[model samples]
Target: MKRLLCLAVAAASIPVSAEDRTLEHVLVSVPIHRQESNSVLPVTVITSEELQRSVATTIGETLENRAGLANSSFGPGVGRPVIRGQQGPRAITLQNNTSSADVSSFSPDHAVTVEPLLAKSIEVLRGPSTLLYGGGAIGGIVNVIDNRIPRERIEGIEGAAEYRYDYAPDLNSGVGVLEAGFGNLAFHLSGTSRSTSDLRIPGRAIDEAALAEQEEMMGHDEEHEGEDHEGEEHGEEEINNSKGKIANTDTDTDVITAGFSFHFDEKGSYAGFAVNNLNNKYGIPPGAHEHGHEEEHGEHEGEEHEGEDHEEEEHEGEEHEGEDHEGEEEEEEIVRIDMDQTRYDAMVHLYEPMDSIEVVRGFLTYTDYEHKELEGSEVGTRFKRDTWETRLEVVHNALLGTEGVVGLQAKSDTFEAVGEEGFIPKTDSTELGLFLIEDFHRNEWTYEAGLRGEYVERDPSTNAASNEDFTNWSASLSALWQFDDNWQTGVSLARSARAPSTEELFSNVDAMDPEELVTHAATGIIEVGDPDLDNETSLNADLALQWHSANSWAELSVFYNQFNDYIFLRNSGEEVDETAVYDYLQEDAKFYGVEFESSFHLTDLGPGALALDLRGDAIRGDFKDNGDVPRLPPVRVGARLSWTGDAFGTWVSVLNAGDQDRPGDFETDTDGYTRLDLGADYRFSFAQERELLVFIKWKNITDEEIRLSTSFLRNYAPEAGQSVAAGIRFSF
Candidate 1:
């Protein structure tokens, strides 16, 4: 396979850009693996330079602008990527094709382990080829590619370090990395740290009266009992203030990775092993409070009550009563939430080409992740999981005038929740699957088809009482046609399925009360009947077109996805009459949308080249009377203008969100607003091998009080207002 790829490379006569030359000539290059012939799949590639140029804090935030992607944020510190509107366990996150081993499925507060700053490139595989991954990848796959281990035998060492700071939004961040190679051995390591204070709006903060009006228009009362009462009082006073500061919104992260590879020159193959450990300590947003109501009566009340009691028990010194009162006040329960997480992952990869036929590749990985949350009165749920995966594939050549590929994979996972009482029962899951892919191409037309057969088993350890086993199949077909060097069109149809995770099955604990009115409920209070949950299946179809001309690029896509037995947590109005009570249930759902994006370069400018980019998405979907999947984002459109030159680059973008009427049983409609972001960078050469990038960014330029549909705190806490940030990056 390596020789074939080499031959193809040598035979090609395409002009290579300077960036491409640097990657292929200076850095070790690996064969660009192509999906088997006749398979209809689409993969989007994001270069490292793109990541560097984006003013994003997390991997999910960086990709949110991409087509067909969305992000759910837990304040500014955490975010999860959503592909085609599907998230959680259904979307697999990979670091070099291995699971990230994080608790992303359990909640939105947890951060992914992959460091966006350290990544070399990001690959998003859509369509059928996702079956090559585990069954969890029903949505798609996000692979964070990095050069931690040597891809080829080398003889020396190389490393780079960077530091960045942004002042407008009050942010400071830095990273350090090192890599070394000796003969066939290599290693890489990196660390990053960041901190930010309250983010300010771009202009004058929204007037308190305006906020009240907006809330009222959205069917939300400004003075609901135990709901934003303080804001209401402040509004009554005619005081205009900035949005609440993002408390504990700082972050400290560290990562260490190392690997060793052995080059087999005779066999034209390389075998390697790698391990990564990530530790992060970040702030969780503050929960909303009901007015200025103190949890306690007051010091005067306690003293007065103590005095009365002392009079009654004059013989029993008052000192004892005073001490008791103080203790009681100090011990009053006040919810203070915080989170800590750690992940460890190890993987092994082997590549070898057979003397005849095709090349064979094998991969095995083991991952362990632990997450813990601390909150007053809450059960403080903790989850730990261990997963093992192995895959073997055989790439076939066109011996019979047809090219194709076949693969087999098996995965086992153990998920356990300790200290959750009886709410979340420990679970063990195992899955096995076999897949085949065939790719065929003739002139300007390409076609592909693939299918996968899978078996899954789930068991509850606490009570040998509940267990389940099921078999499922997934398939997809796609076709792409190129009309010219600058135009291409494609269509795809696929069937996908997702099994339930432990959290969806038995999570029975009070996670947290973001809104003060909602008290905690027993985990899985709604209950799970029969333990025999069927798989959620979906049929999806999409049509896409791409046009790339000399200085311009554009893409448009339309898609529809229908699901059978879509699993959702429904607001069971009964809820023991409990506020914010929701039950897990299954129902049918359908989602359809169209997205368009385009970019045009205005080269006839002054000192720098100018470009305009526009993108938008409109989606409408419904779930069986479940009140329109709560937290589904609203239709949004955005446009950006950028200028790049030898020493300076800058970009400004405006985003607008449409109103959302979809509501959960206990949910309310959300108003929409517009925001603006502007950023600029200046480059300077410091030395022969060092450079610097000084940048500044302003977000929410209009100071619009925008509310994101994907936010859990939308009821009481609004999204952050506009703010400015400036930073410098020094590289060596």
Candidate 2:
């Protein structure tokens, strides 16, 4: 590792292109066909070139500690992105501009379904994007774009494959993506498989919060220790907590997809369809999720030899367990997540400029998704969602003296969850929305405006107040001024509203059920819902300033959001099912934050140019009467010293997060920590215009014990310890 570090920083004379560090990357997720550096809203585009070098098993881990992003992680297996301090129903996750339709938004323990290995790029839109997407994007949207539908025809055959291995978790992953075309027909295929063993941690995962809850779990440990005399208490044994490792956090993931498209070849008219499926099985953090028989499973390793003698009989018994009421009672059920999704999408595009319309597009998608919480062979809970969505948009060259697009969208989703531990009630949801957007440039001023009206209805099988209907309107207005030759400024104002989710309205039934059953897996507290919760309304104002050039760019944004009826889940200082009770409540709330991104190129170095990239964000969340809102991300700052070389490139960064002392009611304070991360990649041309890329990334190099203020399971499972990941990719 040390020698590799030397090779990374040591300058080798390889001419590097300065344009590689420019901000001219075209962003496909931009509402308007504008470059990222000129977009009105804050958009961060992680290009395929960038993502390939920093890909991870989970999105949260992949983006953790970024400017305004954090991972609400439940061990290594489960991590959901928390954007600008908002998660769950507030942030909308998307794939190719459509909802991911996964359970990750339903619970913090759930994992995001999309695979990064197949993505061409990942776009993150900051702040409210309700007019373009929907009310669900009040927080923001993350769109993962891939060639699932073969938007463009390939000349012949082109593909990419990658193999990766990580040291910390003993992980191995293989990925392959192929694109081929014959005449006007194009086909795309991609697949990835990944598996990992238990993750090693810096310590026993014993933080202050864990220490407080350890008393209740002492008995389980004692019982297992009594089963055998391993001399763990011997004089030669190490006593430091670092000797212990995080348990039950292993994961295995697989994804496969196929797509085909037929194009006009002459005109820009094309139609395509794609099918994709994902299967993932991963363990929950040890203490956070447990099956009653902790001692039995804990000592299984010691008893494995004895169990092998009876393995044949045990296998036979499992087959006939239906006949025996209490079959194989000794088999310990491991708490894990088993999920799969099969999705189909079809899209049509016509670019033959009509008299008034410049382009016309239609999109339709159907998804069948299901996930389960498994305890041994029995499923503790099962969740199923079936959705059909359709959208049509018309882009006109000139409309009302401005260039703009009008769109109509409709969707129907049926969600059902059943099992002993299903917390939220089943519901059927439908939505209809009509939106219009216009943007025009006049002299030194650029103006944009949008309006959207949506109708939403939620019906629950149970007659609970969770049933609801609403017709809401959202609008946004923004204006940008060319302050100078290379400087621009803009301001935007919006009125947005969001209806309650089934979980927020009907979850009154669940107390984080498993959190109570498994003391360690607790999601901080038990949460109940108020069916009478009203829609949340927010008025937002944002100001942005930017300076852009060929080799440098910088942007700073400040925003303030005021809410009349802010719905939230708050700890009520009570107990339900042996866990602290949290109830869905509403009150006046306010949020203010600042986000900044900038990159500057210095003088040319040996064979490359040196650049300093910097970013940071801070926010404060509060209620009118209540002291503070819960689970807000910490104030953070980070910087990267980058060197762009022709064949060899590297960047080293240090990220610092301030301590979170102003926790919400019933919340605990978290200590702050600093982390160092390093990345190095070398590209070699094996053939003309074709390259093989080899990269190495080292994360948490100092092996800091990080407890997230935004995650409920932080105390139980800190982030992964020091890890070294290396991978090679072949691309044409």
- Against the true structure, whose lDDT is highest? 2
TM-score on alpha carbons, each prediction? 0.79, 0.86
Candidate 1 on 544-605: residue-level lDDT in tens?
88776767766677778888877665433332222223445677887776666666676747
Best by TM-score: 2
- Off-target runs (Cα >4 Å) in candidate 2 are 1-18, 21-23, 209-244, 265-267, 290-333, 508-526
Quantify how close model 2 is to the true structure by its C-alpha RMSD in Å. 9.2
Q: Give the TM-score of candidate 1.
A: 0.79
* Residue 214 alpha-carbon offset, candidate 1, angstroms: 14
Clashing pairs in 2: 287-520, 287-521, 288-520, 288-521, 333-376, 508-529
Model 2 Cα lDDT, one tens digit per residue, 1-732: 122122111111111123644635666555455576556777766777777887678877666645566777777887777777777777778888788888777667778888877888788887888887888888778888999888787888999999999988888999999899998999999999999977777865545343333322333244344443233322222111223466566788999999999998477678999999999988766434421111110011110111111112222211221121122332232467899999999988788557888778888989999988777678877889998988888878866669887998888999877776666678899988899989888988889889999898988887545468888899999998997988999998999888877767777443334343222122323447677777888898988898877788777787888977777655453433434445677788888877776777876899988987777777778888867776677777767787888899888887777688766643456778888888889999876568899999897899998887777566557777898989999998
lDDT of all the models against the reference? 0.57, 0.70
